[model samples]
Target: MARYIDAEKLKCSIDSETDSIFDWDMTIEELYYNLCKLIDDEPTADVQPVKRGTWENTNTPNQLRCSNCEIIHFIAQYPHGEINYCPNCGARMDGVLSE
Candidate 1:
């Protein structure tokens, strides 16, 4: 997630810090930048685009095949809406998939 500075809270905090007896090792702006850098260093995961496919019914009543992988999957029911991904290839079917 991206971080943003809250101007009102920062102003209030700076006002209170002005009354503190602690000696300044760095300028207030420099200290603020350092604190923000620490928060911005948090890890974020990247989502990669994957091959998309829909399930196609097979000869077996409860089995469906993946359009992308052509691997058959067995489920409790046929034409089920709950099956969202191809287990073998991880092709997504829950959202709008590109060719």
Candidate 2:
């Protein structure tokens, strides 16, 4: 599992620190750059495949939904460890479940 910190929360923490230590003098560009750096330095989670099975001949566990194309893919069509991109839309599979 991966841990994620909201960027707004991080900015608030930085703002509090800089205000107390430097009189709130940090530029917006500097803050933005620091936030980007922090995000880039954060560790990425290992890709874990969603659980899959068949129920009454239908795909179960519903695999991962594509965020870009709004498509639900069956896990049986894709080989394990080879589903980094969406076959329908060529989009990156962020592994985020659809609502």
**Highest TM-score, which number?**
1
lDDT of 1 at 96: 46
Clashes within 3 Å, all models in order: 0, 0
Residue-by-residue lDDT tens digits, candidate 1, 1-99 = 544555555555555655452347778777777556544543343445577888777777767788889898888743555678787899886544222
Off by over 4 Å in 1: 1-47, 77-81, 95-99
Candidates in order, TM-scores: namely 0.42, 0.32
What lDDT is obtained when candidate 1 is compared to the true structure?
0.65
TM-score of 2: 0.32
Q: After superposition, how far is residue 16 of candidate 2 from its true place, in Å?
A: 53
Model 2 agreement with the true structure over 7-97: per-residue lDDT tens digits: 6666666675554434357887777776676666545544554433211112457465665665667767876756777777676554534
Evaluate residue 83 in candidate 1 and report its C-alpha lDDT on the 0 to 100 scale: 78
Pairs in clash, predicted candidate 1: none
Q: Rate the local accuracy (lDDT) of all candidates.
A: 0.65, 0.57
